[model samples]
Target: MPATILIVDDNELNLRLATRVLEKDGYQTTTALNGFEALELCDQNPPDLAILDVMMPDMDGYELCRRMRENPKLKHTPIIILTALSSVDDRLQAFDVGADDFLSKPFVPAELLARVKVFLRHLEVRAVGNENQMARKIAVFSLRGGVGVSTLATNLAAGMSQLWGDETALVDMAFFNGQSALMFDLPMRNTWGDLAQIPEEEIDAEVLNQVMLRHSSGTRVLAAPRSAVNADQISEEKVSHVFELLQEQYPYIIYDLPHDFSATTLVALDSADKILLLIAPELASVRAAGMALTVFEELGYPDEKVELVLNWNFQSQGLPRGEIEAALKRKLSIVIPYVADSIVTAITMGKPPILSMPETPLGALFEDLAFRWSAPEQKKKRPESPTDAWRRIAERMRKRAKAASS
Candidate 1:
């Protein structure tokens, strides 16, 4: 679908130029001479996007942005400031006034079109979340093997999907040894390994879904490969491709990562909206989790992106809350009380505790945590592998050259 864009500027020439450029690029644009007119037009007929010039008579871009944010009708609309101000402070002020993006007056037309495309892509991704924030990406992973990583991931995704009345997908990036399929009694038929045979150029959401199998409860599983050789073929490039495709198609993309680090794992981690590092209340789990935290920190993962999850599934080796805090020297974000016997039985029976037994203590835990982690977030990083890095650098140089010419 074509996005409806509103171009608001005091100067008629600027408006005409922007409108012509956007229309030429296959966008539907509506023009307003000033902020007052734009506001009235928006209240009457809302647009999917708006580009406002900073300097205007009666109302400036900053005030216009503030007013747009205040209006419920235009609250979620993407606003780009096309202005002559290029200073850091001016950009910060624009952001403070609720601008989604900013553009300088003398910008290249290609950059303008690229920025507009970015806004449109972003708008499409966020349209669903604008009404319901709970159906967003949530990643559950761990450093140690048996801290209930898959258990938490399976149940949490099932619980969330049920609560939202939407489908949730559990992605088993644990490669060969992943238990996500086993947890749901799903087979490895046409696993992520199948994607390796498909040409990367033709891989889209529809092709990706062919490899995924649906559970009886509307939960989907992208099970890992059964063979190590096949898993080896599923490289970082494939993982990055999957994340991009999934975010646009699925409401949630939960990854059950392998116990150790891999290039593909890092790409998945970087693309995650939230990370749930499952840790047991023991010294071993704490130490392992600390090492994992160091890795994430070294890669510049924000503290807010990771939440240390204490999975207290046993009594003997259990450590107190203070003991955990003292061991890791960090406050825990969430802790699940030990729901020992029944939850294990459900998993053994190849059923998610959240769906099979929603009234159980473990199911309730998943539900409460799902509600708490419903806010939208994104990570800012380039590709993970060295080859991807080289490709990105080349792409950047090419773009710079193109911009210089333009």
Candidate 2:
């Protein structure tokens, strides 16, 4: 059966237009001219999603949304607020009232359809999560700084979102001045600091969702606190609890870890399904990588649990692959060539290469890596509806296999 949608607007023309657009897309839509009628309709039969116009006769969209959130039957329904008010305060008010998304009035039909598709897709994925499909967690770590840990983590998260067409979590574990949010050019509206004062038991999925920064690419970021002092308030227990909740919701969780063995870092590392140990070709980076491997061994991590990633951060005079492998006693699973200009441009623009330059070499490399690190179940079977990123990666794999055979 098609998913049911409830559209509430004071204007009959607006209601009919929205209803027609949605019905054309095979969605079953019910329209109401006011919030009271909408409530009555909702009480009789709830909808999977709702689109509300801000201006209404008896009760505005804000009030209706708040009331729906309080209603047990409709609390979890995804709400999108449509209004002519495009001010920042209006958008904030919509979100404050528990609206999932906001769109300015006179919206393009295509944009409206796109937003609806994304929310419905998310709802379907959440249902799958309830069936015990735990997310695949990947932690990107390096003992030394500036080895492109954040770079890789951000790109990996973005790539996963594009490949799977679902939201991927990019967690900034670097409490002090982490740049995950900045890399995505998202504002620091909310962060882990928001949950610092809340009791661990009180931090549920709803709370986590409010605190996360949602990127346009569908990669949600749990950013580091804006103030460094807030970092001290986040305990290891809180980190562990948050990770547990995140694993239940997201399909992929990527951690951008800071350079240290702090308790909080340990919690994330412990929870990870796979660890990407990144190392640059320099001597200090190599030494740091060795130390990290020893620590992993001490922790009794299986050999296959940790994968070595050799990153060429610099252009020249780097150690040879043979010698680096010999020194570490582990083969590098992936190697990233130096692309200084591209990296600099990406940082300046606050867009990951995977999303910005996906057809380029660097972008394609990260896309392939994301597919490789995807859950085994996802890799075993083809997606029912393959995304563009999936199709591109599949084509590349086919071409490579053909070349080898020939």
In candidate 1, where is summed lDDT lowest over 10 consecutive residues?
378-387
Model 2 TM-score, 2 decimals: 0.79
Candidate 2 Cα outliers beyond 4 Å, as residue runs = 1-19, 26-108, 119-122, 125-129
Per-residue lDDT tens digits for candidate 2, residues 168-286, read 99999999879999998766768988888799999998788768877768898999999978988999989989999898888899999999999999998888999999999999999
The reply for model 1, stretches above 4 Å from the true place, is 1-135, 376-406
Model 2 Cα RMSD, 1 decimal = 4.6
Local distance difference test scores for all models: 0.76, 0.91
Candidate 1 lDDT for residue 79: 80
Give the per-residue lDDT of model 1 (tens digit) for 211-241: 6755545567888887788887876777777
lDDT of residue 57 for candidate 2: 82
Which candidate has the highest lDDT of all? 2
The TM-score that candidate 1 achieves is 0.59
